[model samples]
Target: MNNPVITIKNVSKSFGKNQVLENISLEIHSGEIFGFLGPSGAGKTTLVKELVGLDTPTKGENFVLGGKMPSLGLMERVGYMSQADALYGELSAKENLEFFAALYGLKGPNRKKRMEMVMEMVQLSDDLNKLVSNYSGGMKRRLSLAAALLHEPELLILDEPTVGIDPVLRKSIWDGFYDLKKKGTTIIVTTHVMDEAEKCDRLGMVRNGKLIAVGSPEELKENTNSGTIEDAFLVYGGA
Candidate 1:
């Protein structure tokens, strides 16, 4: 019954002769975790990039917050963490958070408060004073996640966020996601991991640049008469 926070209409993307996405249509409602489930090269990242306005769809439109994407005004309301880490290696984790917070117009005590809150969510509080270049791959990923959470955006988009994170930390991070969702934050997480996809409220199965199936984990498993999300993915001919 809630309004759709995101809408993709017949979206397609191509790079010259190579097509990366084909006629993908989807609508993500507010206050839920919607996931794009797929293997590498399945166009999951590309689709999200389009939604975040980093890239344009070759032949469709992606709307976020009821407005077409790439709109600068919407930036403050959306938080994005790409498949690649985008952090200043020379700066401390706290400094990186400070920079992003300032860009969102957060200042003084509010900015400092937000930085601490986000870092705590990612369990990187101890390393907040450490330079990013000194952090490990997993640590860097967590820092990127922390920065994205600093603005407390209404919509959160993460691409392969838990890739290098350990199991315990990943679980804690997902707990943080649940907390965000309860606060009515709409989240989109792209991942190839079946178990991770199972955590989503609904999932879009993608393969070879095509959207093969879309449903909640239970619905998908029931439809395919499968035991698990992985089995259901296979039944959908993903593998």
Candidate 2:
């Protein structure tokens, strides 16, 4: 196994009286695609938000790249895509990419190269000059993904990245993910989609703020005595 790239140590989060995560602890290895598999409101997104430094844990700690999270210095080393499309509606896709690239301190030829590369990865190169407001839901999602890849961060955190994507495009995006993994990038993706979960190197199954199981897809199926990931999830979910 590669060195630990992310470590969640007994993490917990609560909003008001509601606890979203409880005593969650896990380690994600470098250069692997780790999936957070669960249904909506299962605290998957909350856990990811803390991992990306967008939110703080109510208790315990999260470390990425060996440093404590919510650190500004680590922001540039991590790429994040939220469940929502956080794009500028009036700006052209290229402009949006440029704006975010500038934020990451990318400039000149290097910036241009990364912009082009990410656009191609998401298959949105042709729509570069189009205004984001005019783009479809799926297009916006792809563009958001491209933005996250702008800095070529070592860690990528995505929340339901393929929610609005068509099957063909979703496959293309997953292919891109594998390509990134080959290049030694670590990815953490949260999804309720069963097929996508099978593609992960390992999975942490979350349900009602608890991490019930952690293992490879095949291992999960074998341990559950199930034929598919979905059935395995059901076994873990007590259904």
Q: What are the Cα lDDT values of the candidates? A: 0.92, 0.96
As a TM-score, model 2 comes out at 0.98
What's the TM for model 1? 0.97
Which digits, one per residue and each the tens of the lDDT, describe model 1 over residues 36-58? 99989999999999888889999
Using TM-score as the measure, which candidate wins? Answer: 2
Clashing residue pairs for model 2: none
Q: Candidate 2 residues 130-218, lDDT tens each? A: 99999999999999999999999999999999997999999999999999999999999999999999999999999999999999999
Please name the candidate that would achieve the greatest lDDT relative to the true structure: 2
lDDT of 1 at 220: 97
lDDT of 1 at 118: 88
**For each candidate, C-alpha RMSD in Å?**
1.0, 0.7
Q: TM-score of each candidate?
A: 0.97, 0.98
Q: Residue 50 in model 1: shift from native, Å?
A: 0.4
Cα error, residue 70 of model 1, in Å, equals: 1.4
